[model samples]
Structure formats: C-alpha cells, structure tokens
Target: MQNSPKKEFRNDEALLDIQDRPTFFHWLILSIQHLFTMFGATVLVPLLIGINPSIALFSSGVGTLTYILCTKAKIPAYLGSSFAFVTTMQALMKADGYPAVAQGAISAGLVYVVVSLVISRFGSNWVDRVLPPVVVGPIIIVIGLSLATTAASDAMLNNNHYDLKYFAVAIFTLLITIIFNLYLKGFPSMIPVLLGIICGYLLAVMVGIVDLQSVAAAKWFSLPAFDVMFVNYHFKWYPAAIIGMAPIAFVTMTEHMGHIMVLNKLTKRNFFKDPGLHRTLFGDGLSSVIAGFVGGPPTTSYGENIGVLAMTKVHSVWVLGGAALFAIIFSFVGKISALIHSIPTPVIGGISFLLFGMIASNGLRILVDNHVNYELKRNLVITSVILVIGIGGAYLQLGHFQLTSIALATVFGIILNLILPQKARSEK
Candidate 1:
C-alpha cells in the first residue's frame, strides 16, 4: 500500500507516499483540487449532448467509485463523461432518439466486459506483444491531436477572423499556468491549472464576458432528471443502435490503455502489472454501463485528472474517493452546478490548451522512455502509418459501424507488427 522505493518525489526532502494518508482537512483540500481539475471537462459531455449536468456529475461519482471497487482500490482514476460518444450519440439521438443512444452505450460497455474477460483469462502479454510502445505512442498522440481543433476553436472563438479578447484571455491563462508550473513552489505549483483558471475567470469577469445570471436564478438543491432513460423511451431495444454502439467500444479501449499508461508514468506505478490491465479495463467498462443506466453519458478515465496527478504528486486512492463524494454531493446542489457551467469558455480553452498538449507530449515521452527505435523500417512504417491515419481523420466504415483514427491506427499497428518480420541493419 506504500509507495515503491523508485517513486519520484516532487521535493527530495518532502516525500508523500500513497500510504501516507493525510488529515481530514488536507484530504478535503486535495480532493477539492481534484474536483476543480475534472469539473471543467466532465460536464462538457452532457452540456454538448443536451443531457442534465447533475446526472452526469452524479454518475461520474458513482462510476469512479465503481472503478475503484473493481480494481480493489488500487487504481487512482476518476471515471467521467466520455467525449468519444459525443458525435455518435448525437447522430443516434437525431436518428433514433435518446433511448436508442443509451442502448448503444450499454452495448459498448458489454463489449468492454468481453474484452476484459479475454485479457483476464489469457493475460496481457498478447496485448503488449501486439500494441507495444511503438504502436501505443502514436495512438496516444492521435487521442490528443484529434482534439486539437476543438481546443483551438474554444480558445480562438472565431474560425475566420482573430478575436483578440478571447485570444488574450487564453494567452494570459497560459502564461499564468506556465509561471505557476515553473516559477512557483509548494502548493501553488502543484495546482497550476486551478490557479490559471481562477486568474482567467477573474479577467473574464473584468472584461464583462462572464454571464452569471443563470447561477443567480438556479435553485439551491435539485435532483437529476431521468426522463431520457432508455426504459422510459418507446422501443429502446433497436438492433441498429446496438450494432453501431458495440464497435465504438474498440476505439475507447485503445484510449483507455493510453490513459492507464499515462497514469503509470505519473504515479511511478506499473498499474498494468499490479492491479493488471484486465481488472482496470473491467472496471472502466462497468463504469460505462453504470453511467448509461443512470441516464448519464458513457464514462472513461479523465485525462485532466491524470494531468492533476502529474502536477500534484498526490497519488492516494482515498483522495479520489473524497473527490467522488464531493461530486455526488454537488450534483444535488443546483446552484453549484450552475456556477460550474458559468465559467467562461476562454478559461477552459486556456487550461485545455496546456492539458491536452501535455497528453501529446507524454505520448512522445513514452517512445523515448521505452527506447522505441525509429531507425528500423518496420518501426518507422508503423509509426508513420498510425500518426497519419489517426490524425488525418481516416475512417473504416463497416455497414453502420465506423472506427475512428485512433481505433484504426491501433488495429493497423497490431496487424502490421504481427505480420512484419524483424530484419537487421539496412533491412531494418
């Protein structure tokens, strides 16, 4: 339960191990920090898809707890609303309705359960052999780069012309984040993203850009609305929805691995080797299913939470438990949810710019750390193909099902790796 001797302490003199549980006050403070780190991105899934934010928050808390239990309290991750299902869910809802989309997510979660069982029975060697650093690195890069346009759009606020106001807020936030990360020390340095957000939010208010009228009118307490549940809708068991949703799970599983890899690096713990990939994947899938049943968006490990782990150096499962509890409590408080939604887009844009870039950088770091040789022809081919197909928006459509760039790259890399022969010198 304690930290490994190989743990990299942020401060050489002050080491905080996983087992070195903090006081109640300290735990609360750290947990609140985790809350802020995840809150900005977690609610966006429901916000974009026109679902109740309270339900998303509540489900995220429950989902995270479910993951923790499934992993035997070993993995420190917060499962929240996934962005992967955004477009597909929208299309399904428009075509078939919300009930159909919910059914699709449930089907996808079932697919994860099957994949997890396979890994659990046969072990992760098959996965590692097929999707090693060479393959996983570019896939992770694609996960971040694919979202580049969305990040830029949020920051720029204009596709054709420059909007100096929003752009300046983004830059200001970015600058403060850099300063907090590099120049500052102690607590402030650990929560640079949170600090940057506070600064940007204040600036946004000064410029008269923030709108808090909704917060002012919102009730103090409210329950989640479950009117869109699959059971509530007529004919929710459409075969087409299940067919379309099941394949999306394959893509998400790849992203799940990347998230686990990043967590491994951040905490200096080989979670895949410890709790094992089978358990982690099972937990993730179960969380997704749990979210779907509650009328929330499908859940996945939050990359923003991983970023928080990397920055804060606080790797305690109890802290995550506290965050989950806070989320659950906040879900019932209508005003709190409104306040979270009121945070201007520019602030989120500025923070996401740094957070998403860090994710891509970590992917590259994985390559270097693992000694993935670019000199080998097979390696070069694998890397180039994955990066291009993943970032280029290439799609593999089968009937109504489709695999996006990351999923395609993962499949292609595994196939290419297994088939390509190892050669020496010039041939390599």
Candidate 2:
C-alpha cells in the first residue's frame, strides 16, 4: 500500500520527461520537411479566403509560436488556418465588408475561449462523446468534396480551359502523389505532394499551360504584404460575420479535440486530463485570434502534422520551435510568396486536387476507423442532409448577404448530428 504513492510519482516524472524531451539535428531536419509538407495548406487558406498570402505567412508563423506557448510546448503540432473557414470568410468580406465581420469572428474566437474553459474545467471526454467519429467523419468527407468544386474554379485562375486541361492535370498529379506516398521509398517519398507539384509544373510549362513571365517579374526581395488591416476592420458586416464564422467554431473545436485525442493516444499520457483539452483549446483559440489580428485566417491544430510527428518518431517540441522560427523568417520575405505563386496554376491545381481529396478521405477514414456503420435510417438521413447541403446545394443570397454552401452544409451537419438518434454502440 505504501508503494502506491511512489508508483504515481514515477508515472508523473515520466510524463514530465515526455513534455521536456530534448531535441537533436535529425529532429530539426524532420521538422523542416514537415514544414514544407504543410506549406501549401498553410498558404492555401489565406489565398482561398482573400487574405493576403504574405500576411497569412506572417500570422501563421506567429500563431505557431502562440500554439506552442499555450500548450506549454507539448506535442509537435503546427498551427495553420483551415480552408473550412474559406467560404464563410469570403462571404463575410464580400457582403458585410470586413469590420463588423472581423469583430464577429473575434467574438467567435471568444467562443473558443469558452470552449477551452469548459474542456479545461470538466473533461475532454464530453467533447468526444458529443462529436463521435460517426458525426465528424462524414463532415470531413463533405469538406473535401465540397472544396473540389473550388479547385475546379482555381484551375481557371491560371488557365481558361480549366475544366478540360486541369481535370487531366489534377488526375495525373493526384495519382502520382498517391503512388509516391504509398509505394515510394526513402525521404523523397515522404514529400509526395511536393513531388507531384514539381511534376505538374514541369508538365504544364512544357505544354505552355503555365505562364513563366511572373517568375521573372517577381522581385527577389519585394516587401511582404502586412498592411491593409483597418480597411477590413472598417468594413462592418457584423451580422454576416456572426452568422458565417460562429458555426466554424464547431468545426475547429471538433478538429482540436481529435488532435488532442491523437496526442493522448500517441503520448499514452492521457493529456485529455493532464495538460488537458482546455489548455489545448486556449492554445488553438489564441493562435487563431492572433492570426486574425494580423490579417490571416483562423488557425487550428493540424491533424496532418500529427501524422508527420508519428512518422518522424521525434516528438521534441523544439522541432516545432525551429519550424516556427523558419516560418517567421520566411514571413518577412516577399520573394518566397512570389516563388510559390509563380509555381504555375496547373501545379497548384493538381496538388489542390490531391491535398483536398486527402482531407476528405481523412474525414471518411474517421468514420471507418471508428466503425460508424450507416445501415440504420437515422445515420443515413444525417449523412444525406450533410452531403446535399455541403456538396449539392449552391450558394444562397439574401439581398446583400450571401451564405455559402459549405458554411450552410456545416451548420446543417451540426444540427442533424445533434438531433439524430443513436443506434446501439456496436462492438469495437
């Protein structure tokens, strides 16, 4: 009986060891590679939602640092704005202007603060119970499929025959990316998305599908975009902002819980109770709030980055610390943005097709991994409504205000999931 306290003490010490783990060069290298992997996704959100790419870069850089501090530098998670918020942000910007909407989103960030507090005070298990794999899984799938439509539009951003040519480019790059990721060996294999991007650009340039003039015109040390904050602020669209950004709190919150759950599974420390979901939520919310202030989209703890951490087998928080430094360093440089933007639309178009689809697949994977069977009528209806609203319906407009299909779909998903009846939990 006297040994009980000693045993608990040893376990506590070991947990501390995991949190205070040291870093080495290999960890740094791994972190750098991971950074590159997320670069596209990182910039994609700001670009998609009309936020300045350069400002997005800066915000993401700072936001990452904020995330680390908030989580006490535990877990190798990287923070970036999510594309899920794209439609809502764009709509808010277009209709209500930017000020009121910005306030509304800032208010929405406060929602995250509340959520963080709840998770901290009670337990994260409640969040998990409310949004089980069954609910979140299909929603992820819808997000991916829904964005595919936008990818098609972007295929046009750099080319007119976007439908025909980009469809081909997208298919080719996607298959290449999948093959490399699944079968390729070694470090080169680790960045299949990057490889697909390189190949896609080459193919596009060779066929004259991509314009090369921008590459030369792009200055080596041009000033990064950090201005234009007040203009967006003055544009009051509070109603639209509230309606549009509020619901996304649900998406980001659910995603955050899932990442925290993953860290718990990986660290085997049950962080859901220790540093706790509340701490993690504050980190995530604070990170996004910072991103918004700097004219960037809201950030979230990335599940993909978690996969990278698992693969690297190096959980040194310092790895992310290095990555944060790297992002910050790049944020101030203008040439980086020009180079990324100049990479040819066909290349981005192709990569977007793959990355976006993978995002959707992850959502689908969530449902499958958790064994959320949909043979029952209730499950079927919940999924059907989410898909139609997310994937089938077009944008809706009321006078000056417009509600995007994606945002609408998300709202629809949350409602249906909450209301849907539960079938008996099957065997794991």
Candidate 3:
C-alpha cells in the first residue's frame, strides 16, 4: 500500500520557488500565465449572477492584492469570484434586491474574519483535527458535484430542448481542450483553456450563435459602473439577507482549507504552519468584504490558479501581484470586458464540463493520495453521508435563512468526526 501523502514531500523540489527573487520580465510573463489560468472562472461568476463582468475582474485584481498584503506577501493565491454564493446571491437579489445582497456579502465576509480570530487564538491544529481526510474529502467532492447540474444546464441554456448546435460546440470544445492539454508541448500546452476557448469561440462565430453587437457597441475605454454597491447603496440592515448569506461562509471556509492543503502538498511546504491559517483566512475575508463594497461577487482563493502553480512550479508572490495588475487593467478596458461577455454560453459550458469535473477528481485524489482506507466502516460512513447530503441538496432552515446542502454537510462532517469513536478512528 502507498504511504499517506500527508507525510510526504516532493522528491525533486523547485530550485527557485515562489519566494525566490527573479527578474522583472520573468515575473511579468509568469504573472500573465496565472491570469490566463484564472480568467475563465473569474468572469463566469458575474455572468451567471447578473453582475457586470468588469466589476468582477476589477474586484478580483483588487481583492487579490488585498490578500497578498494581508498575508505579508507570504502566500501566492489569487482571489476570484466565488461560485458557492450563486444560489444565495440570486435569492437575495429577488428578495431585497442587489443592494441588500451586497451588504449580506459583506456580512458573510465578516464571518471569515471572526473565524480567523478564533483560529488565531486557538491555533489551526484544532481545525485540521476536526476535519481530517474522512471529512474534507467528501466536502470537496460535494463542492464540485453540486455544481455539475448547473454547468450542464448553462451549457444547454437550461432549455428542455436539446440543441445539437450547442451539443456540438460543447463536445468540440471539450475534446480540443483535452487534446491540447495532453498532446501539446511548451507554452501551448500550459494554456489549453485559452486555446480551447478561442477554438470554440471561432466555431461559435461561424455557426451564427454569437452576438457581435455588444462588442461593437462597447466603447474602447470606460470606467466600469460600480453601481452594485456604491450608487445603489442603501444601508438599512436586512436580518434575513445577512443571516442567509453569513452561514454560507462556513461552507466555503472548508474550500479555503482545501486550497491551502493542496498547495502545501504541491509545493512541499507547510503554508498552514508557516504563514498560518489565520492570516490566510483574514486575507480571504477581507477580499470578500472589499468585493461586496465594490459591487462584485464574493471572492475566494481560486482552485484553477492552484492547478497553474502545480503545472508551472513557479511560486512567486510577484507573479500573483502581476496577474492582479493585469486583471485590474482588463476591467478598465471596455472593449475587452465586452469581448469577454460576448463569448457564447456553449463555449463556456465546454470548459466548465472539464473544470468542474477536475475539481471532483482532485477531491477523490486527496483520499487516494493520503492513503485514506475506505475499507474502514467509520471512514466509509462519514464519506457516504457527506456526499449524499451535499450532492442531494439537503437543506436545514433557520428562520428565514436556509443553510445549503454544502453547509449542512460541512457541519455534519465536523460534528461526526468529533463524536466518532477514537478507537475506530485510530484503528483505521
């Protein structure tokens, strides 16, 4: 049997890690690579939630910068629009409109800040102890699987009718993306997503599925409308909105932990111990609060960018800083923003099919890599329960607020892990 990856480090470590000092040009190129890696996901959130894509891009850049500064430039993670808040954002928008939703997002962010304080006081070992592989693996799985239907639904335009045009586009995009990722070499292979998108978009344009009017009508340069929070600011607190959104933070916090854990494994460094989880959580929370105030979606440390780091093996904080700068620049350029919005849904669906599935794959990889024995009944029971609860969209209501399946499953996993027999846990 393979040894647990939790105790293993890379045999061949990068001579020049993210902290290594590099030339300006080298850092710039690496940063741009990181930006391209996260570009698709950064914009997808706003597109789904009826927010301006420019605002999301801008907020991501600023939020990421905020994260970098908060962690004292020790961690190299990018803050991007979070998909976990989609359902709640939509519901809050319908209930009290976008303004209340924004405030609620800020409230949700404060939850992270509160949790960070708690961790700082008690240390991160408590957290890891409560959420071991048996618990976290299933939560990560649920995060990806819960979004599967949404990805497919968006690709098919949520219509009951199945259009071959979209199906063809999705298939072509997915196939080409996989092909490029596996067969290509050098820089071309590094950016399969950008290439796949271009191919799918060209096909979409030729098939008359794309609308060019938006791109043509958009100005060459203009300031993004920050109206979601600034112009639409109405500060009367809504208990339901705040209560509804805040609890979801607990759900995404697990995701934050997963991101840190994966990076630690990939880089063969204990970031959770070095920079500490408290500081990372503070950065993440601050980014979300800033995003809320700026009319952007809640931001989280992007898993896509983590994949980029593993592939490239260049781990410089400056690289993330450079990517954040480019994202900010993209937000100010109106034509660029419009161009992003003009990409066909089918094209995105093709990529989402791959991206979301990879997330689930990574979750399972966590179990296998860690040598987590499914043969143990305790491990099997915990994983099975969390997956069924989260994937099945089970909910628990607290007054006007509804805790999502992810949130419920997360709470249950932590509770189960704590209460399960110590002897059974140790024997496994």
Candidate 4:
C-alpha cells in the first residue's frame, strides 16, 4: 500500500532552515521594502494621538525586534503600531483627567502581559471559543467604519474648497493603493503602498502643499521630546483600556493562527506542534505591551509582510532581522526620518483607503472562516444588531469610564453567541 503523502515544501527546512540565510544584498533590499511597509505604521500611533514620533519609532523597532526574538524569527512577519489601542489611550487620557494619558496607557500594557501568560499556558484556541466570530467581526468592522472621520478629512486635502485637501489626498492615495495591490505588476506589485505615497507626495508638491522647510530644519541627530518609559495609574483608565483594546485581540489572535497556518502551508511543517502558536502569541502580546510602555502604541500581526513574501517568494528570516536593524538606525537620524515625514497627506490618505478597507475586510474574513450564516435566529439578531449599533455609535457609560459602541457590542455578541444554539446551522 502507498504511504500517506508527506507535505511538500519549497525547501526541506522551509522557514525552519535559517542556517543558510539571505545574502547581505538580499537582506538590504528586503529590509528597505520592510521599512517602507512598516515605516508609516510605526509612526502612525504617536502621530494620531500627539506622541513623539522618534520615541514611537524607537519603541516600534524594539518591540518588533522583541517579537522576532521571541518567535525565534520563525515567521517572516513585521510588527507595527496597532490602531486598536489608540482610541483606548485617548479615552484613558480624557477619562483620567490627567495631563497625558501615557501613564495609564502604560498600565494597560500589563493586560497584554497577563493575556500572553494565559495564551502561553492554556493555548490560543480559547481566545476564540470565548470571543467567537459574531463578537470579534462586527467590532472590527466598527473600528474601520469609525475611521470615516479621518478618511473624509484625508480626501478633503485634495481640494482647497473649505480646505478638504487632507481628505482628497487620502482618497487619491487609497485609490492608487487598491489598484496596485489588486492589479499592478512587476516592481510596482511589491511596493504599491510606497508608490501610492510617492504619487500623492508629488501631487501635493505640485499644489504647494508640502512644507520641506521643516524637514530641512530638523537636525540630523536628536532625541524625540518624549521617548521613554513612564507609568501612570488611573483605576478608571485601566478598565477602559482593557475593555476597549483587549477585545480587538480576539481578531488578531485568529489572525496569528491563520498566519501560522499559512507558514505551515509554505514550509510544510506544523509550527504549532513544535515551537507552537502559544509561544508566538505570547511574543505578539509582549511586543504590544513593550511598545505601550515606551509610548509606541500596540503591536500587531502583519498580513502585508506576508503578501510581500508571496510576491517575492523570499523566505529568509534575515530579511526581517535586517528590517529591524534599519529601523533602529533610522530612529536616530532625525533628517532621514524628517524626509519620510515630509511625504504629502494625499499619499497617506490614498494608501489608508486601501489599508483601512483591507482591515475591515479582515474582520469580515473571520466571519467567513466560521461559515457564519445568519439563518439562525440568534446569529442573525446578534450580527445585525452589532452592525447597526457599533456603526451608529451604540455606546454605554460605566461610571467614569465610557464604553464605546464597539466595545459594548463586542461584549454583547460574546454573551449571545455563548447562549445561542448551534442547531440552526444544520437546519438549512
């Protein structure tokens, strides 16, 4: 009798075979691309919530490095600033009535630590069994839809009437990104995000929207004003942070599993069976916790870098390590970073359109993976209600801490999914 077929791989080692690494040039090229992919995201957290960019960069670089080390560089992924925590941090600051919310935000990092421990000990599957698709999906959808304010503002930058140039830039940049990511080819296929930004920057320059004088004035080397770890504790802020940011991890946890599955498919090895998913997730959670401590924002599993791997077909971990090293170097060179910061608004907006939309799509993807059919009365009601309430700002106040429509909806979905009968799945 024929033996059961063994999974074929690109190499016998696939990802595990890191003994033969990418050449220096290969590392350099991949690092450059990785930097571009992660660059905007790293700076994005601080930029949105009024934190120092330099420190954010430094923290992101360090956090990403930590994740790489924890995972033993088994996965070819890039960790970036997570937007999920931005609102939580802002809410913490406002709720605390503190000078800066960074202190309480620091405390929130401990939540990630606790979560990592749970995942590492018991396993990551429970995260989903508890959160479920109904809850995690809609909450993710709301997070994306909630960005409409900024998305619209980005499009406004393209037009001067009422100075909506910001919004216009965003729309234009987004369009280019979609076209490239979905259709463009050759070198353009790999760096679609970068290309969109370049095009938008040029357009903005044509319209005199760019201010290079600031970039020119920025020194070659200088520490960012606020780029260190400091802790602040507000009991009220802690709960808000946990409620708002923790639920989002439900989606990311699944994403981490999916990524590991993909890496398994690519390498033809079961990662979870050996070094393990729990270990990787522990790294992911710790990476975010570290970033928050240094005011960098939360870190998350990145699908974009995965796309790069698919495009380039280069499975060398050295490339990922190279990217981190480059980011560390850039953290100190104020001038080079200043140039990156000089890129125009429209480009960012354009890229954000696709990036943000893809994020929303990921949430929906989770539901699809679960075969989430709304035929069941419970599923139908929970899903429909969540969509409307979260998108419509269905929120509740819990004393000093206000629960966002998304967070409230998340909790409600979890409870409903728990009690709901799965018998309906077989009905149709």
Candidate 5:
C-alpha cells in the first residue's frame, strides 16, 4: 500500500503536497481555480449531446467525490464528462432517446468494473498487451477525427444552412482560445476554453444572437433535471446502444492510465502502486454508473485540473474536494444552468474545433512517445486500416445491433494488433 519515494521538485517546490492541509482562504481560492479549470470542458459534453448542463455539473461533482473517497483521498484527480462518448451518445440519443444512452453508459461502467476486478485478481499488464499504443493511438485519433464534421457543421451552419454570422463568431472564438492558450501566463493560461466562451458569448450578445429570456426567467436556486434511468424514464437495455458504447470504456481506460502517469510525474507519488489502478478504475466506473442513473454523460479523469496542479504546485486532495463541492453547489443554481444552456451553437463549435483537434494530437503524441515504429509493416498496416475504417464511416449492422466509427475502428485495431507478427531484433 506504500508509494515509492517522492521525487524532489527541481525549481519551485510544491506549495501543498497531497497530505498537506491548506488554510481556509488558500483552500477556497485553490479549489475555485480547479473548478474553473474543469468547468468549460465538463459542461460542454452534455451541452452538445442535448442534455441538461446542470445535471452534468452535479454528476461530475459526485463522481469526483466518489473517486477521491475510493482512492483513499490519496490521488488528486477530478472526474468530468468524457469527450470520447460524445458522438456515440449523440447518435444513441437521436435513435433511441436518452434512455438508451443511459443504458449504454451504465453498461460501459459495468465493463470498467469487471475489468478492474480482473486487474485486482491478476495485474494490469494485459491492458498493455490488449491495447498497446499501436492500437490505442489510432482509436483515439478516430474519436477526434470522426467528430470533425460535427464540429464544422455546428460552427458554420444554422438549421442546415451556412450562416456567415455564425461562422464569424466561431472563428473569433477559436482565435481567442488559441491566443489565451499560447500567450497567457499562470492561472489565466490554464482556462483558455472558459475565456474563449465568455468572449464568444459577449460577441453573440452584441450581435443579438443570444436570447436573455431564459436566463431572466430562471430561478436563483433549483434542482437539476434528473430525467434518467428510473427517474423520469423507464430503463431499457438496447443491444445496439451497448455495442456502440461499451467498447469506449477501453479507450477511456487507456486515457485514465495516461492521466495517472502524468499525475505521478507531477506529484511525485506512485498512485498506480499505492491506491492501485484497480481502485481508481473502480471509482471511475462507479461514478459513471451514478452519472448514468442520474442522467449525465460518462465521467473520466480530467487533464485540465491536472494542469492546475502542475502550475500551482498544489496537490491537496482537500482542495479538489472543495472544488467538487463548488460544482455541486453551482448545479443547483437555476440561473447558472440557464446561462450555460443559452450559449450559442457557434461558441460551442469554436471550442470543439480546438478541443477535438487537441484530442487527435494527443493520440499522435501517444505514438510518438511510445516510439511505435512505422517502418514495421505490422505497425503500418494496423494504423492504416484503423484510420480508413474509422474516418471512412465503415460500420457493421445486424438486426437491431450496429457498430460504427470509433467503436468499430477500436475493435478492428485490437484484433489486428493481436494477430500481427512482431519484427525481430535482427530486422532492425
């Protein structure tokens, strides 16, 4: 249960370690910073998928708390709505409504739980063998690239017609986000997406595109819409929806590993060995299960909040817990939810432009970081097939079940990786 020795900070020392308790004032400020860091991306998922943003906020708060408790308050990580499931959720919502989406998400969570149990009994080595960088990197790429058309459509079109005004707003927002990300310093630099949205909203307001009626009519305090599972809708399992969604758990699990590695480097604690991957995965799975039941998207560990930890050098779990509390509090404020809902399509599209591209880039980064040799025919063939199938919109349908896009690509990539022959040392 003990972690490895802490690595010494080379430059400025960490202001707060994982176990360090910050004073009330410092804790509040630090916690609020983490909240802001996660807010933009967290809410964006539910917004795009036509769900109540407030519920997403509430679910994320609860999910983070669950993760913290499950990890023994040792790892300072925040869970938020995952982007990996966005396109799948959107399609499911369109085809079978939110109930199908909820069932799919719950099924995905169960997949995580089962995998965690197996890892607890055996080990995580099988994870790498089944989902090596060669397979995983392209799957991640497909997730982002497959969403490209959606981002573009939202950015440039209004009701299926290309609108110059909407396109202009999208471009402006994209520029603002890029500038803030590249040139800003310290805390402000960490929240380029939030800043970009705020600026975009103001521009929309000026152009008379944003309607204020909903925000004005919203109450100051109210409960988020919990129209999920057995709340407002009957629970029904769709095999098609489960097939489309459950495999995504594997992709996000790899992402979870990456985030854990990043935190280990930044905080100098061996979380994988201490709290253990099994515990973290279980927490994430349980959180998503709760989110599905309560009407929200699947949750995963956020890299944005991790950036805050690396920047401020504050790794206190208490600070993250406080942030979770803030998110929960924000969700009940009716005006806030209304305001988030009022965000124009162009603004969301603009943010997605950058965010989705960054996701694809991270996929490339995995390949680069792992040094997956493209010179090998096996590597080339796997990568090429995944890209073509994923981006070309190839799918398999049987009766009521269907597999398409990222999910299909992921399955193909894994099978290919398992069967492909490895190059010998002499081949080099």
Candidate 6:
C-alpha cells in the first residue's frame, strides 16, 4: 500500500496533517497531549475489571504501535483498552479466572481477523451498504452522547453524591479549555485540552481533591504485572468463555468503523480505501491478541484521542506514536503511573466535556456534509431509532452475551436502513 503524501499547511493554520511531522518540541508536547487524553479511559477499563492498570497501559502502547505498523502509519488512530468487554470480562474473570478471560480476548481478536479476511476477499462494499451515512451519522452521535452520563457523573458526583468541589473544578477546567481553543494562536491553540487538564489539575490540587499518597508510596521503577499466556498462565480454551466474549468483537468492530469514519471526515481522506479496512482490522485484531497474551484488556480505537485530534487538528501518526511510547514508559515507572493515576476524576471529566462534544459535533457534520435528506421519512426513521436505542440504555441479551448501547443501536440502524424503502414519503 502506498502512503498518502503529506499535505502542506501554513504555520498560521496550526494544522498537522496525517503525514506531517512537527518539530521535536511540538511533537513531545503534542504527544503528551494525547497521553493525557487517553490515559483516563484506557486505565479505567482495567481498573473496572479488577486487572492491573499498568498492564493495560503497556498493552495499549504496544497495541497502538501494532496498529500503526499494520496501517502503514496512514491512519492516525490510537488503540486503548476497550470498555465494551468490561461486563463479559468481569464475569469471565469470576467464573474462569484471568486465563479464561485471556483466551476469550484472543478468541475475540480472532473474530476480527476472520472478519478482516472476509472483507479482504470480498471488499468492503457490503460494509458501505450495511452502514450508510444515515446510519453511521447517528451511531457516531450515540457513541459520543452515550458517554455524556459518564462525563457528568465524574464532573458532578463523587461516590454517587453531589460534590461542590468536583463541580467547580470540572466547570473551571472546561472553561479554560474553551478559552484556549477559541482565543489562542499558533501552538497554544492546538493544545487547549492539555492546557485545560493542567489548569484543572492545579485547581483540584488546591481543592484538596488531588491525592498524592499513592504517588508517594509508589516505587520509582517496576515491571508491569505481566501474565504471559504460556509463561505465567497455561492456555486453556473455554468454549463458554469464547462464546461469551467473541460476539462483543462485532460490537466493537462497528464502533471501530464509526471511529474510522470520524477520522475520514475530520481528515478528508478515505483511510478505509488507502490502508484498506482489512489492514486496520488486522492491526486492531492483532493488538487485542497481543493484549490477551500480556494480560491487558482488549484494545480498540479510542474516541478520546480522536477528539483530541479533532480539537487540535493534529493528525500526525508520529505524534500518536510518541503517545504510545509514553504509555509504555509510564507502565514501567511506578511513580509516574501513580502520579497520572492521581489526577482527580473532575479534571478528566472537565477535559472530556469538550472532547465528547467535539465527537458529537463531528457526527452532526457528517449528516450535514453528506446532505442526508432528513426530510425523507426513511432517513428520519434510521437516525431517530439509532439515537434512541443508543442513548436510552437499550440492550439486547442472547444467552451469555449481551449487546448494548452504541453497538445495539448500530445493528438496529443497519437493519432498519436495509428494510425501509429508500424513497419514502417526504414531510410536507
């Protein structure tokens, strides 16, 4: 596959295209910006599932590098621990332990591999037919909106109770981010999210919300709690575990497509056509397999990083690579990891407030850019159903597996689009 040519932009533009390379200083800061953006969600998945957060950080870095290599550095995306598998993985961890969960992760990766092979053989035409703009737009919207509650909960609530300090910190951080994004020039303009996070963190520190005890207790350096498949844990195939986890791959795959579509719209380049969806899928799948072997949670394209890309207009794969490196390095440095972990929830919530809104706005941009005729009842139905199902906490359960939120909405949207007549009665 040929690499896309680097697009030139003026210094005043402050835009870093996919193939563009920033200066060393700019690169480091930009990369750190992404690190801050993805750290919370990536580590949260493992923490929620009772796994080692450091391992997730390490695997996320490795997984991102794998994805970069597989996509030939053409797609500026980062892979991080996926939240979609949290419930199933938690159950697997309880029932069959980490071994079964690892096997299940590998099984899920294989499902992506299988799907990628099919797409490679048959091309992605069917994918287009299955997920048109009408369906994809709202799915993207749902993906962002679905996370709204999480953001709000983090910003406004502490242990499910209202916290004035958290609310103030969150609002203050968000305002700082907005001001930077709107009024800054050149380099500062591109890093509003990072700046907001820093200022918010300081505010959190002043408010006594920042806990540094963990950092003080942490060692300077340490190895991640690795659980190598063959070395640390014996490989065991549990059909029930595989059955429980494998189907979730389909769910994440749809989310992956939505992320890719978001990137396409943001970058104005068709990555699916360039690096080929097959390559992207292979990278993502292989990353998950590697994560499984190493005891990290399953990895997928991260929307937080995507939101940073959108906000900063920095799409350099090199910058993303640098973030991956930091993740790996942080995984080994106990104090550093502890310090990052100590960042108050409100700070993260504050950053997410802007980032998630950017994602939702991009979805709206898709609808507008594609000129989707909302006047048509067919289009209206597809969009409406996706939004309701995706944001309303709707879910579908089959035996041991459950499909919920954005994934369920995507499936329903696709089905509705296919069944509904293309030409429908328009509103008067």
Q: List the global CA lDDT of all models.
A: 0.79, 0.63, 0.78, 0.62, 0.80, 0.89
> In TM-score terms, which candidate is top?
6
Write the residue-wise lDDT of candidate 2 on 1-428 in tens digits.
Answer: 01123333133422122334333544455556556656767888766666677677677778788877877775567887676566667767676554544555565577788888876667667655555656566666665677676666656554454356665666677677668777876545545655776777677676666656775676666555553456534543456577667666765665566556555544445666666778777877777666666567777766556655443334556666667777777666656555555555545556566656656766676677678777776678777777777778565565434455655665566677777566634511
Which of 3 and 5 is the better model by lDDT?
5
Model 5 shows how many backbone clashes?
0
Using lDDT as the yardstick, the better of models 1 and 5 is: 5
Supply the global lDDT for candidate 1: 0.79
Model 6 lDDT tens row, 21-117 = 8888888899999998899889999888889999999999999999999999988999999988898898888888888888889989999999999
Candidate 4, residue 245: the lDDT equals 55
How well is each residue in 314-419 modelled by candidate 1, as lDDT tens digits? 7778888889999999999989878877777777788777777777777898899999987788889988998988889898877666777778887888888888
Q: 1 or 4, which is superior by lDDT?
A: 1
Error of 6 at 193 (Å): 1.0
Error (Å) of candidate 2 at residue 95 is: 8.7
TM-score of 4: 0.71
- State, as a TM-score between 0 and 1, how close model 3 is to the true structure: 0.84
Q: Which parts of model 2 have CA positions greater than 4 angstroms off?
A: 1-51, 74-77, 82-105, 152-160, 163-168, 222-275, 301-323, 363-369, 373-375, 393-428
Model 6: worst 10 consecutive residues (lDDT sum): 1-10
TM-score of each: 0.90, 0.71, 0.84, 0.71, 0.74, 0.96
Off by over 4 Å in 6: 1-14, 425-428
Candidate 3's displacement at residue 128, Å, is: 2.6
Itemize residue pairs with steric clashes in candidate 3.
Answer: 18-315, 18-316
What C-alpha lDDT, on a 0 to 100 scale, does residue 226 get in candidate 6? Answer: 96
